[model samples]
Target: MQYTGASIRKTAAHFNIPSFKAVSQWERIYYEQGKDALFKEQRGRTSKMGTKRPKKPKTNIETNEDLLAQVQRLRMENEYLKKLNALIQKRERSEKSTK
Candidate 1:
């Protein structure tokens, strides 16, 4: 209420608010609508279009070994790409030196 023309930072600090942006929004709402609007629910609707579908759980068929193998394969591919990039950069440097 003391923030009629006062800075938002000072108001937030006076109230020990983590984010000054919240104070800025509250001030905007207070001016536009009223102080009662601040007491109302500020959260938006959870779902407006339709109800959300829950995620399906993986079956027991997905074993730990299969997950580990997949991770190893991805790591090998990432290492191969890094080595290939280094070789390409080396070749480019050599070409530049020759020019």
Candidate 2:
């Protein structure tokens, strides 16, 4: 890998590489082995702790109290809708009778 050409040209000459320049380039990358001599750059695969499990967030009793109040508000809204529906039904019945 460091000074790959001189040995590769000799090996290629023995096996009969077509051109001296081609053997020189091949030896520069890989002297004896054809494909394995190329150095692959792999500097991006290290773990950076950015994807690790995070600490649990803090939860107070006030947050629970806020959720309970929201539930109570929804329940009151459901009751109001039921009363409004009954009033509409009664009005429709009275109008039908008058007609």
Residue-wise C-alpha lDDT for candidate 1, range 1-99, written one tens digit per residue: 563767889889889998999999998999999988989986976666776799788666678899999999999999999999999999999999999
Q: Give per-residue CA lDDT, model 2, range 1-99, as digits (tens).
A: 245545655766777876777667665556465576655543566776677688787665468788999999999999999999999999999999999
Tell me the lDDT of candidate 1.
Answer: 0.89
The RMSD of every model to the true structure, in order and in angstroms, is 19.1, 8.6
Name every residue pair that clashes in candidate 2. none
TM-score to native of every candidate shown: 0.41, 0.44
Full-model lDDT, candidate 2? 0.73
The Cα local distance difference test for each model comes to 0.89, 0.73
- Model 2: residue 86 alpha-carbon error in angstroms: 0.5
Off by over 4 Å in 2: 1-62
